[model samples]
Target: MTPKVSIIVPCFNHAKYLNECVESVRNQSYTNWECIIVDDGSTDDTEAVSRTLESDRIRYIHQENRGLSGARNTGIKNASGEYILPLDADDTLNPLALEKMIAVLDQDPDTLIVFSDTVTFGHTSKKSNLQEKFTLKELLLGNKLYCTSLFPKKYFDEGIVYDEKLRHGFEDWEFWIQLISTHRKQPITKIDYPVFNYRSHPETSMIKEITGNTDKKEFIYHAVYEKHKALFHEFFPSYISLLNRKTFYEKKLESIYSSKPYRIYNFLINLFR
Candidate 1:
C-alpha cells in the first residue's frame, strides 16, 4: 500500500466555504489520503457541514477556540498519515496536487518538505509571492514556503510542531524556520507546477496585520528571533547590518514624507485624482 497522506483543514467560521474545501481533497487524483477538519469553536454551521462530509476516510473533530495554530495542532495530533499537508478552509488544491507531491515524497527521503507554486484566484488574481528556492539566510529573512507545503510526520515526532503562541500571525513562517533549523541536513524542494489554489478575498491575509501594525510586527519578529537565537547568532553581524539598513531607509522615507515638496506633490496627486 502507498503511504497515506493526511490533509488537515482548520476551519473557523468558514462554514460557507467548507463544502467546496472538502471536495477539493476528495477530488485529489491521489487516493490514499484522509481529510481531517478541525472546528475551532465556530458558532456558524461548521459542525452541520462537516458532519455531512464525514466518513471512514474523512474525519471531523471539534475544539474550543484555540486560534489557527491551536486548531492545526489539534488536527495534526489526530492525523494518521505518514505525511501531513495543511489546507485552509477558504483555499483549495489543484486536481494533481497530491499525485505530484506524493511522488516526490516517495522518491526523496532527504527532501523533508515539498511545496509547489501557487495559483491565486477569486476576487483578484496575482503571481505567487514565493520563489522556487531559498537558502537558510533567505528563509530566515522572509517566508519562502506556505502553510500548505507537504512535510513528513517525522519533523513533528522530533518535537517540532506549530508554535501556538504565534496567534498574532506569521506562524507558518516561524514554523518553517524552526523545522529547517532542526533538520538542517534535509532540504525543502519545490515543484514547478502551480497546484495550490489560493483565494484572494476581502478577509485578505492575516499576515497583512504585521505590515500595518508595527507593534504586532515587532512582537512576532522578536518572538521568532528569540526562539531561534542560535541561527541568528551564527549570522549576527550580517543580520544586524540588514536591520540597520532597513532602519536607515525607513527614516529616510519618513523625512521625505515630511518635506514640503513631498507634501505639495501628494496634494497635487490627490487633487488630480
Candidate 2:
C-alpha cells in the first residue's frame, strides 16, 4: 500500500497566495496525498478562499490566531498520514517533490528527514545550493533544512511540536535542532536539485525578523541558546565559548551602530549601495 503524505499549510492573512500554494500541491506528480489548510484567525478572505478548495483530499480548519507554530500544531493534530510536509502559505513545492522524497524514505528506513534545495522567487530569484550532507553541528550553527521537508509522523508521535513561544522568528531552526538532537544517529536526506520554491517579499516574516530591533533579536538568540543549553554543551562544547563571544561582539556592534557617528557613516554607505 502506498503511504499517504499530508501537506499541512498554516495560513495567516495569506489569502492572496493561498490559491497558488494549494494549486501547486494539487498539481503534484504524486497523487496519494492530502492538503490541510489551517487558517489562523485571518480577518481577510481566507475562509472563503479555503471553502472553495474543499474536497475529499483537501480540508480546511480554522482556529483563533495562535501564531505559525500553533497553526501548524492544529494541522498536525488533524492530519492522517504516515509522512508529513509543512508547506508555508506563500511557498510551493516542485511537482515531483513528494514522489522523490517518498522514494528516499521508502528505501532507507534509517532516514529521519528528507529535504531538497530551494529556488528563491518573488523579491529574489535564485537557486539555493545547500550542503548535500546533514550534520548536527552545522545545523546547530544555522538552519539548512527548509520547513517544507518531508518526515515521518514519528516526530509528532514523539511529542515534538514547533515552539510557539518563538513568535519572533527562528522557530523552525529551533525545532530542527530539537528534533535532530534526540535522534542523532538517524541520517537526513538532501536532494541535489531544487524541490521547493521559497517566496521572499517585503511583507514576509523573514524581512520583519531581519529588520527587527537588535536587542530583541539578541534576546531571542539567548533564549534559544538557554532552551537547548544542555544539547549544545553535550554535543559541541567548543560552541559555548564561541556563542559567548558572538553575543559580546553583537552587543558592541549594536552600541556602535547606535552612535551618532556610526549612524552618519551608515547613511553615507547606504547611499552608495
RMSD of each: 3.3, 3.8
Give per-residue CA lDDT, model 2, range 1-273, as digits (tens).
Answer: 333899999999989999999999999998999999999999999999999998889999999999888998899888888888999998988899898988898899778899888998998798888788867878877788888888888788788889999877778888888888888889898976577799988664663764466666666677788898887787768766887787799779989989999999989999999
Report the lDDT tens digits of candidate 1 across residue range 1-273. 433898999999999999998899889888999999999999999999999999888899999998999998998888889999999998988899999988897788778899977888888887685677678878888788889999988778778889999999898999898898777888688887776788887774676767778788778878888898789878665665676677689879989999999999999999999
Alpha-carbon runs more than 4 Å astray in model 1: 1-3, 238-241, 251-273
lDDT of each structure? 0.87, 0.86
Clash pairs, candidate 2, are none
Winning candidate number (TM-score): 1
Model 2 / residue 62 / CA error / Å: 0.4
Best by lDDT: 1
Cα lDDT for residue 166, candidate 2: 83
On the 0 to 100 scale, the lDDT of residue 185 in model 2 is 89
The TM-score that candidate 2 achieves is 0.87
- The 10-residue segment with the lowest total lDDT in model 2: 202-211
